[model samples]
Target: ATTSIAPTTAVATTSPVFVPVTEPPSATPPPTTDAAVAPAPATTIVAVDVPASTAPPIVVPASTAVPTTTLPPPPPAPVTQLGVVQDVAASGPLTVPVVDYGLPRVALGDSVMLGAAEELLARGFAVDAVKSRQMISFLPDMQIIRDGGSFGPVVVIHLGTNGPFSESTLNSMMALVVDVPIVVVLTGRGDREWIGRNNSKLRALPEFYPNVTVLDWEVVASQCPGRCFYEDGIHLTQSGQDFYASQISQLLGMG
Candidate 1:
């Protein structure tokens, strides 16, 4: 038995070992990681100062300038010569008024004359007046009177209150009583534009004809300082009528 145990050989046994189960690292990173990004640059603001002396001035144009107003000239001044006869005075030392009331007298006019009809009749004048009478329409009546030989030595005419009369018409009217002494009454101040123009023609009559005379009633009526006229300014008040009658009377040497 000893010989058999000695002849048996001894056998060797090995055990298995394990390395860590790690895989190779990837080329791209995982979604769990977030990368930080850089921000853009901001703009900066700065302030500047300006000088007052270098500023531009405001201008206004001459074409757009405000216009000035022009008013009309005033009426002509009143004539001073009332009833003077220079030729007659030059001829002799005797001086007489332009009218004679001793002879038959006629009064012709418009509504203004009608206002003083009774007063004129009292003063020995045949009153012939029509309301709103124009000089053109009244010329025919004057012609009728001239043809009939009823035109008296003295004539008092007050017209042009209703409307305008031409220089030719005035001349023709005066021709009707060429030889007779006539008294032309200047119209009072009124709203009518023709009043001043008519009075101007009336005032110049004596220059051309010796038989003509102006009563200058405009001057006379102005003395009352707005009391002489009724609201019409062309017609007379009671006091105005008295003054009117008295002026005519004085002119005729009756007052």
Candidate 2:
């Protein structure tokens, strides 16, 4: 009975509505196995210089970031000058003696003595020097010097210009003239190691013998340096001869 009163209302059809859905970026997958992989750091190369650098070598780790610039190597140390002033300091200041005007003296040595022979004679010293005779001929030369030592109050030994000497020979040489007043000049090294050794021996003489006086010729040569020596280094130049004579004369109070 109610359907007859209804005013012809149409029945609605049942249908599902379709809608588009967007989910955010799918969670990005967390990089999976790639995240577990370890990477090695990059490396760089550098040049090395020898003489300019005194510092120790630098060490670098592989994984560290490469430096933009390396530290520059330090400049090398200057070479020490030979025949410095300190070379003669051990011998102390030379005693200026009261000169007797023409005091008697004698000298014995090698080629160095040969250069000084003229100066020695000029200074009124009774000089007996043989060329190229080293300290090894100590016995023979000491006898010659000993004979003249009786006539002169002072004796100068210049033998080590040729080479090295033994301690025993040096002792034997010293024993021959202990009673005599002696002045032993230290030998010039001239870049030779043995000459330095011989000079060291001569420097030690005063400690053992009270009558012995050590003349630091090494010190004298250092005063004028290159000008004091000849081209041969050990031999005296004309100026060197004069200087040596003057130093000896002054030491003995002859000056």
Candidate 3:
């Protein structure tokens, strides 16, 4: 059989048949992704130092000042002058000139004078004292101190123990002894109120008459107590007599 198969072979013709094939590419589109965010850092604290020279100084307030004051004291009381001289013009100026000579002491009184009679005589005093006789006023005794009687350069009056007094009568008695230099008054005493008043009047005589001196027998009565007076509180006792004499002597510039 000489039948020859037509040789089947790839024909390379001018217009060749072609088959199409598809495969995924290796460059895929970038995968879709979100951006990453970072966290912030923490804050730190720091301390500072200060010097003493850089600091402010402190101040103090002062106290207020004050003033001081001083005062003086008062004057002392009178001694020989017993009290204030109120009635200085009770009488005129001293008329009788004071004679610096031997002045005799003459005393005029009632019973109290009698007690001191012997002592007065012994002390050179001419005493006109009455025994059991009453001189209740300055009237009856005016005659005794007048004329050339008990009136002398120096005299003692111890009346008014039994009665009241008159200022005129006392002034008159002083007038009767106007020529006399010194007159010592023996203050009277009794249970009567007038007695003290009488004594006060006598004490005030120093202002009116320069020669007037108060014996202050009241002082003697107070000092010597029971020994200076009798039971009646009016008459002078024996000790009183001695005391009276000594006082008169001192007044007469003898003791």
Candidate with the greatest lDDT versus the true structure: 1
Q: Give per-residue lDDT, candidate 1, residue 8.
A: 69
Q: Candidate 2 at residue 245, lDDT?
A: 72
User: Considering every candidate listed, which one attains the maximal TM-score?
Assistant: 1
lDDT of each: 0.70, 0.64, 0.65
Clashes by residue pair, model 2: 97-253, 99-253
**Model 1, stretches more than 4 Å misplaced?**
1-103
The digit string of per-residue lDDT tens for model 3 on 1-255 reads: 697888788877698769887767769876757766465766666776755595567666677667666556665332222232222233112222345443456777777888889998987788777764434454556564565354656777777676666888788677766656666677776677778988888888888876676676665556553478777777778888887676655644566
Question: Model 1, residue 152: what's the lDDT?
Answer: 54
TM-score of each: 0.59, 0.57, 0.55
Model 2: per-residue lDDT, tens digit, 38-150? Answer: 67877777876657767888987569776698778996542211121233333233332333432356676677777878887988787767777877775775775466434
RMSD of 2: 22.6
Candidate 2 to truth, TM:
0.57
The order by descending lDDT is 1, 3, 2
For every model in order, what is the number of clashing pairs?
A: 0, 2, 0
User: In model 3, how large is the Cα lDDT of residue 161?
Assistant: 74
